[model samples]
Target: MDEKVVRYKKNSNDIHVLPPSPYTEVPKPNVRREKLSVENEETIQTKKKLEKTKKNFLFDPRRKTFLGRSSLNWARLAAFYTVFYFCLGMFFVILLYVFALILDREVPTYYNKDSTMAVRTTATVVGMGFRPQPMVDDSLIRVSNDLYEQKRIASSLRLYRDVYLIQKTDAKAEPCTELDPASELVPGTACSFSWFDIVSTQDHPCSDNNMYGFKHEEPCVLVKLNKVYGWTPTKGPLPIHIQGLRNIHNNKSIAKPDVYITCDGTNPSDRDAQTEMVYYSLEKPSGSSKYGVIPNYYFPYRNARDHVQPFVLVQFKNLPLHRLISITCRAWSPGIEHETRGMRGMVAFQLYRSQVAEKLIKDDN
Candidate 1:
């Protein structure tokens, strides 16, 4: 059908034109992603700031800062301590000087008669001491008659040998001279101690050959009065008021004032044991004399220079055999009465016979 229907030529513009896609413009970067990136950057900056702060806190050497300030403070504290100690030392020295000024160089601050206050309040009293005190036990004299114990006694005597020998030298000048019977008791006129007379004879109480009587059954006890600063016993007869009836009857004349020593058995049961003991040289064998323990003029100890301490050597002529006796010896003076303290100026000891001492040793073993 060749009909004249001519196909209409498709126009170039008639071809379907595609519309621009909706996502074509490369969609603007996501807004959320941009915000996330910015946040990450801020977080990193904050971490760095924290690290810097921690470093500064640990040890900052900056002037007027932590470590620097601490060092300066320690130095100031040390300087303060040094100055404080120096001032304290100076104050102590000043106080010592003041104390020294108050004290006397030659004399004691509080002593016998010199200090009236001390005399009334303090009352300086001294006791007696005995040499050859028991070495093993002070309370008991446990010397046996056996050879061993006798040797021990000899050793004790030797300890004081030098002291006894001191008399040989003139180191101690005579302090007293023989008193004239006509004159009143004088300071320098009292009879001096004759060391040779006391110790030269073999039969004497303190003879060197006898080991001061340790070898013999008889024993010599040396007694020394304790020393008190500036104290002197009055040199005169014991006041008549202080004299007992016995003393008055025995010493009717009262011409010689003397210090008497009495040794008595403390135990009533043992009193008989002391009956045989006698005080030697109490009087001249030919005539009656005053009690003799120490002479009156030897007293008033005038310092260490002019006077030597006078000691009495007591000899036990007949100590009880194989028995124990308690003996108490005392120094009697008018002003010096029995005192509760220091055994009332008395010394007491226990005397053990050889057999008793040996038995005691065996029992102890």
Candidate 2:
């Protein structure tokens, strides 16, 4: 009933009318998101307030929420595992320290398997007249452990040398290993000693046995040296040869030298002492005995000089001089402490004076 005039427009709503076009002008809805940064301290405080409110609503313990219980269990498990791992690591560290201590004491003192012996020997040689050279195998040229050792021969007839050995026990199975004094081996492994004199006369002269004593007097000889020395073995036996006192060849008269005898050959005073060469006469037992008395020169110092030195020759004679046996010789040296070095030379004799004379005449000598 009221006066209404219709206006021409593209789109017209009875109450609100506008032109119909692709572009429409209306207030855009605001979409806001919060950001926090160090540049503005107020942003951090606002963010904290929002986080607190959301956390309280979502994770209230008194509300008995299943999500809250799951999160708490996860936290408790993580803490327990962290503490367990820490304790386990501490236990291992303590164990390793104890093991190292045990090995340090036992190895160098009790067993003769110390590698430092080699080091000390090397040092001593350098200090003296000799020079040290590293040993090396052709195949192991690039490896660190491969080395060669060489020294010049001494001018003196008596020489001293050091022997070295490397020992190892691997309880932890480390590929790189050293001696473990704390550990005991079932059979024990040892390194071979490679030091000796080029002029050594005994086949297999070992200082350890020379000082101690020969197990079998099969070819017995002893040398009581001033200082201890080591020997090396070649092939089945040592290349060294030992010559007996009876076999000593000299152009001098039949008169014997002033001989001294001592079980303690290493003692300088005793080293110069010599045994009395006593001749014993044997009598025939009226042609009744099958075995005749054979002349024997008894040298009683075979065992005493094995370890301790200055072994003296005890020369005593037995009858029946036809059968020739074995001959052995020993040496004594000068040093502060007396110790046996080793047997130096030996000879197996089966020659007759008559045979020697025939050969000499035949050769026109």
Best by lDDT: 1
Candidate 1, residues 196-312, lDDT tens digits: the string is: 434546666556677666667677666667655545454445645337624453334344455566666887877877745434432321111222366655554534332345566
Each candidate structure's TM-score, on Cα atoms with residue i matched to residue i, is: 0.60, 0.18
**Global lDDT scores for all candidate models:** 0.58, 0.27
Error of 1 at 161 (Å): 4.9
List the lowest-lDDT window of 10 residues for candidate 2. Answer: 141-150
Q: For residues 26-131, could you state the per-residue lDDT of candidate 2 as single tens digits? A: 4554433223344357877889999976786677666644445566676898899999999999999999999887764322342112334344232111000111
Angstrom error at residue 294, model 2: 39
Off by over 4 Å in 2: 1-69, 105-365
lDDT of 1 at 143: 46
Question: After superposition on all CA atoms, how large is the RMSD of candidate 1?
Answer: 15.9
Per-prediction count of colliding residue pairs? 0, 39
Model 1: lDDT of residue 302: 39
